[model samples]
Target: MRKWLTGAVLGYFLYGLFVYWYIYMGGPDSIPEQFKGTSADPGTFMNSRELLLSGEYSRLRNFMYFITVPYEWFILLNVLLTGLSRKMEQWSDSIAKPDFLKTSIYLFWLSLIVTVCVLPVEWINYRISLSYQITTQSTTGWMKDQVIDFWVNFLLMALLVSVLFWLIRKYQKRWWLIAWTLSIPFSLFLMFIQPVVIDPLYNDFYPLENKELEEKILALADKADIPAEHVYEVNMSEKTNALNAYVTGIGSNSRIVLWDTTLNRLKEDEILFIMAHEMGHYVMKHIYVGIAGYLLLTLAGLYAIDKLSSAVIRNWGSILKIDSKKQIAALPLILILIGALTFASDPLTNTVSRYQEKSADMYAIQLTNNKEAAVSSFQELSKAGLSQVHPPFLIKLFRYSHPTILERILYLEEYHAEEQLKESQD
Candidate 1:
């Protein structure tokens, strides 16, 4: 048992090491060939780091990122870990899936428990978040919000777990194929509903009063070739001190979202830079590409698990004190599955996301050329959030979807420098 456990754990560690190595080397060789020497303006530009140390900047960066970074990391890790352990069990010699109906019921109940537990823990974490002086919620307010949050998580979990498990059973050996088919629409569905249904749960969305800023964004989107339906603002400050903006939904749900805090907080040019970055994602079709990549990765994982079968399950199931052959493995199966998936695939995922961000940054820089906004936005984001200016490489690979602000600023400064060199020659 020790030998098997040692091998599995060691293998996992080695995989992590490989990911770090891959990302560390992400320095320059990873730059897409098409993007090489592509800047039309290569002007030397200064960074806003020192400026961010000023008073108001502090209010924005840390507080906002606290919730954003953790929330994204937490949910994503849960999903990946569940997938990994399930596949590991499938590869094991011991995996004995619960009977179809019973398996579905068991997995659903376990998911419900996991879903509900998140509320209290998250509320406690919210309290800890307040210790930072960036949060806006009082104890009573927090509890009320937690109640709303609980039901939101419950519904999302129920749907995701139930549908996913049933799909697994339906396809059985061919689960990968079915998953791919469903994931496409699921991505779109989340995109569509999130603006109205999911987002309002966290913060209130209000119509933007500034027709000028709204018009400005719409014009820039047109100039950038960013397809648009409409642009709007959410009253983000009503809930938290954090300032943020996002581009979510597709088709009818596809709308441009700017945080009311951001509009109130950042200057017009800075806001434009932020908007252009999101436009880059839309113009680049990142959503469809991400969905496709997710399908492929998920299918590959299930296929990997099918090859191994049961031995993986018995080994860890025993170690974890989970029932070896009974339906209890269903939950452990789900948990470990998520953990292992994260352990295996996180590196590749982070790399791809980083690349997309770089591309987005390029587009933003091109449209605005307001290097001041780029730098100011960073300071604003950093000060508001209290973000770790620099993170351990492992954390970045495992957790962050967007490039670290420092890395992003560095990229902007580098591109800005190259543009200056070319212009001097002209």
Candidate 2:
């Protein structure tokens, strides 16, 4: 077991090295020429010094994105292989009377173990962001957020673990099907409460403070036939310099939220364009579609987990100290399988997301009739976020949910030209 773990670590290290070299270090030294001067002066989008910094930041972030998956897998595998999970399960059983209580206790220990193991990586990522001037958050503030995140995750996982084990024990063979059925409403519930409950835990949210801007945004929303009374803004500038806006939640809880950073950094027209793009998601019922897609994926994932967990227990139960799939000690094994499956599915999921984002971009441009705003907004976003205008193919495939900034800008230019030609012909 140790040998297997060691071999996996070595393999992932080599993979990380290859990814850093090929995808990170091998990218273009500067922004592509075609992407420049569309929204601003030739060098205004990203000056030479900024370009170098962005490159270094992007490379580190992309490398981390690829390597984190394997690191997570190693953590879980190590816990399972080292008999820590078994020992934790035994301790939980000795302390708790009921099965549910025991499961919760065991899960808490497992969660803490994994969270601690992953903290250094998280801290390093945060420190990198700080060094790049991407985030202004202090180390103390960041650590506080981590604590909040840990507790929040544990509470949610406790509920989920409780339900999951209940399903597992009650319907051994068909538990995955039942769990998947339950996840539909559970998923929606989370989305519904996210805007009101989950979000406020992370950042302070209030109505958009700029009454004039809020009025314009609401006018845009009304034109889209959205019954929105207010646009929301979050205090993101306190944490990060990155600009962002998004539509979140469903039904009555749905809201449009702009980061204060976006509000401060972008022009009125650009902000309107961003809002319109978010509204596109609402108008097209993308949220519902996303929920359905997620549930379907969950159904498949749970089914795979069921099968894979059984196979692992059968093959290496003695070595891993896990006797059955239903045993609490098997949670690490299940997590490892889920992590692997999620990593494998990233490209498929990201492709679908990119398509939806591109569709939204089209909707925003058509609705606003402001091609320049759309193009400039994309450019500003890239500048603020230090995002790669043209990321490597593998990174784009797995990590990117939206079309790259360069792609979006070029698409807008093409659409504008076509529109102008149509007008001239008419």
Candidate 3:
């Protein structure tokens, strides 16, 4: 057991070192040929290169990522050492009269323990964001959001965990399959209501007030046959300087959301290109495809977890005081295993996301047929977001959900070259 634990600890650090080395030490050669190069604009190129190694950038990146290893291990180690989960379960059983009340109290206290333990790290991350001028939210406002988020998570987890354990108790061996079947509707229910029900709790959103921009975005939607009516603008400048735009929801709920910062900082044409790209997401039905993919992965993960957790309980049930699969106290162990699985699968998931993003970029170029607009939009976004132009290869592999800024710009250049050749031939 000690040897197995030692090997797991060593393996985690070794994997992290490998990722860091591939990204920073391997340098440009680590990146694929098709994924290399910067924008043609000399000013953009110079600025990107400078910012990539800037002190503030380095501080922000390091501060954000450096805690991940220790923080993850801390959650698992603290839970195991202190036996917090088992204590919570025992306390809940003693005081609570009913199963529902017991489960709710147990989940609330457990989540609170986890949250309080991690609060310092969360605050430091927020402070770094503020120091870097990435976030505009006040400390008070941030605390408010944190409180709200905690309650939201606690409530959701209470419901879901209660249902999960109930299924486990009832079905035993087939619990995972039943749980997987149940998650599909709950997942869709959340998605369908999130934009309307949940989003308003965090930020104010309104229809894009600029009539001209709204008309233009709608016109692009029409061209793409996307059935979008009104573009939504989120009040994100109040909290962040990050530029972003996305399409979310389905059917009547479907809409494009532009960050206020995007509208304030970028040109009309650049915004148009962004809107077009979001429209591509809608037209391509990426959301549905993404949901389907997630369901499959979730099913597989649950099946594997069921098998692995049984093995774990068989080996260490007495030590951990977790004698049965139905016990809420086993959640910490389950979380640790899930975290390891997620970390291992990052590259595969990121690859799929990057591929979808590339397709959206191409669709935006084709829909708008304004290669210059597409190119300039990417350059502006990279500059405003302080995106790393040449991220380490391993970072691109495991962390990047979209193609790097350099890769996007290079692809636009290639697309423009092909368009120009076709024009000359015609």
The CA root-mean-square deviation of candidate 2, after full C-alpha superposition on the true structure, stands at 1.7
How do all models score by TM-score? Answer: 0.71, 0.96, 0.91
Worst 10 residues of 2 by lDDT: 34-43
- Candidate 3 per-residue lDDT, tens place, 1-426, comes to 355456657876786676466444554532355544545432444464546434346435643564474566556655654577788889999998877788899888778877888888788888877776778998898999999999989889889888988898899999999999999999998888888988889999999999998998889888898777688999999898879998777656766899999999989988999988888888888999889988998898899889999998998777666887789888777777777677777788889988899999999999888888888888777666656665666657766889987788878889889988999999
| lDDT of the structure predicted as candidate 2 | 0.87
lDDT of each residue in 308-404, candidate 1, tens digit only? 3345555544544343323234545444555567566878998999899889889899988977688778757756665544455555666667887
The 10 consecutive residues of candidate 3 with the worst lDDT sum are: 29-38
Candidates' C-alpha lDDT: 0.63, 0.87, 0.79
The order of the candidates by lDDT, greatest first, is 2, 3, 1
- Summed backbone clashes in each candidate are 48, 0, 1
Best by lDDT: 2
Report the error of model 2 at residue 68, Å. 1.5
Q: Pick the candidate with the highest TM-score.
A: 2
Q: Which stretches of candidate 3 lie over 4 Å from their true place?
A: 1-59
RMSD to the hidden true structure, all candidates: 8.6, 1.7, 2.9
Scored by Cα lDDT, where does model 1 land?
Answer: 0.63
The list of candidate 2 runs beyond 4 A from truth reads: 26-44
The order of the candidates by TM-score, greatest first, is 2, 3, 1
